[model samples]
Target: MKLSSFAVPILSASTAFALSKLPRPHRRAPIVHDVCGSLNSDLILNEVIDSLGRATVAGHIEVCLCLSDVVKFVESNIVAQEAVKLLGDHVKVEALISGMITGLPTGSHCSYPDHARALCTDSNPCDFECTDGYLAFPPEKPTSCKCPNHLMECDGKCGHFKECPSKAPPSRRGNEPQCAAGRTMCGIPGTSTGQPWKCVDVTTDPTTCGGCLNASPFGNAPVAGVNCEDIKGVIPGTVACGNGRCIVKDCAEGFFVAPASDACIPVPEYATVDSNQQSGEAIPGSAGSIEGPKVSRDELTAALKHGAGIAIAHFGGPVGGLKTPRDVTSGIQHGTGVLVKPVEGTSAGFKATRDVGLAHGAAKSLTAGHMGAFAGTHGIRGVDGGLIPGAGTCAKGV
Candidate 1:
């Protein structure tokens, strides 16, 4: 039978059967409608058969399909490869392949992730851990993460990857992971799992360390956990995982750097006000424990005003020789602190900000610089002279 003005022949008996069941509608060219008037219906039903027909469309032609129908079409006697190749474009080809193999429940096609490189399905019985690239699956396996290419299993704690140390004692040779076209290799050998010895690129693999298991690189020791106790050495500094590498950041105030355990311990005299330490334990402070001379808050404030230079925010630092802009990083520090909040039904608030200028906080009212009809968004502005910033509310943000 003929479809539209273009006379393409249907080669397979199954396709011909499906097309015969399609209802006759001609005004809009090609519009598929189910006999039940439902969006989803069985593939074998005749009422929705013609809905799949397309004469031709202008501009960007798009194709939407039911996963079950796709499976039915490919499984038909039609020459699947030749028929699909006739459509061309890698995207269309992938969609058909993925839809057929996914085989999710009737209405579950809408929840697919990237299916360009590989066809994925949650068929594996995951008793252990799944990787980061995986997706929502049956509850028996609560956590399921998948990847485009690698790291799709629970903690396969494969030994230190080659990119890490290169020459370690038990790095394992020839026992590398091999993945099929669409699957990634994961898991460790001789570990908790009875599974074989296979691993993926954990450095970037979200499912393995930083992404799933939360393990980070710690020198050459057997894939160390990203926690401070597991990775830190003799230096008393804070360790954080950024871009997959464990970095040493500045320790918290009042704690001295211990290079030995790579952790910060609270110093006795520096303990003031009995603050809670990093370990989540509270420590009491006594003024009698003060070994050095104490300075009053007014005296310290006076000293900062007199001695400091370069009234800038913070000095950005480099990690692994890579320097990120101060504005992009969260570590940007201001010379003085300010608080900005949303005030409702307060035209006086906007007038209050514009009239006093940005740096200084004089409390007189004038009307100007209407940010918007709703909320006014202001940024931090540069202060005028070395005037120590008061409880100044910046107007136009810099």
Candidate 2:
């Protein structure tokens, strides 16, 4: 005998009404009493039985069995007095269960929550696969799969998009609790039960400064925050979180803090000198003066190319003109001490003499003529004025 969809509802109503007639004293039975009481109303019982019938027809044996347990629990709680009358007509009850189970169409079924069940269709069921970059939450029974962190979901797919989907503003009831002074209440995500709150100080908390980080409540947009210590290229021990922002106290040794920015930049190695002093006098503010062998242009260029620091000294007479220490004051002219080094990614350069003074006190640019005349193929000048040969590279003396 073929069972029709129309006949399933009639079968459920008749069976449920018959089951409800059992004595109320059995409703207190501990085993299935709570389950039976939850479905005590006729409308709830009929709807549950109808769903079970549809699921059974759709070959969902697990769903059918789970629903059947509810009905079996209610049936098992029949009072002893009523059992005699109910079971005496055992054939009738058995026919009712069989008819309800067997009489439904091979339609689709949705295991989603009640509000979302109606949205499910045969083509887009609750068990449909989520698009790439997204994963179904509650893997067994998912309602809406969520995108991974830092990713936004669009058109039912997740990607590296700029804007996130719009969310409703968080509603506020005046009765909500307030945080203490100097603290702001922030929401904690992924909570199962109710909304959880965290209190943070935005002014000085490095991870949550200025606001809560990636925290949203009531489906509102998340607040952005930054960690002060995470700023790139800053000296590790010189960073601080203050006034809801990152403050840098100093930069690395080879770098200096930018004039108008918090960023650190490499120190420049070149500067233009403004001195006319040709005397071989010691440069003021220099750490100290050292008398060394004359440095050839080729040698200076080689050292600068290798990022080695150099100090230059000046002599008055022609290259190799001075011979002895006693001829120093009379033969030697004004000295132009300077220091030069190569800056990374750039050609050889010079820094300010005041910042890095070498031999001469005056600041001046080193020209090819000066390099040829002063650092000729001769010996280096001693502090007292005599030229000495075989002194090592100028960089080593510095």
Question: Could you give candidate 1's per-residue lDDT for residues 1-398 as a string of tens digits?
Answer: 54754444434666899989998533221111111101221122111223467432211212233433344435442444343445543345446444433443432322222111112223321122332333322233222223312332222222223342323433322222233222234434356643333334434432243432422121122443344334323233345444554444545665544434235544433223113222334222243221222434443333223221111111111111111122221111233222222332332222111112222332211111233433334231222222235433344321
**Candidate 2: worst-modelled 10 consecutive residues by lDDT:** 34-43
lDDT of 2: 0.39
Question: lDDT score of model 1?
Answer: 0.31
Which candidate gets the maximum lDDT versus the true structure? 2
Candidate 2 residues 9-92, lDDT tens each? Answer: 999999999999976432211111110011111111222234347311211121221222334523553431232243455444
Best by TM-score: 2
Please give the RMSD to the true structure for each candidate, in Å. Answer: 23.6, 22.4
Q: After superposition, how far is residue 52 of candidate 1 from its true place, in Å?
A: 19
Model 2 RMSD in Å is: 22.4
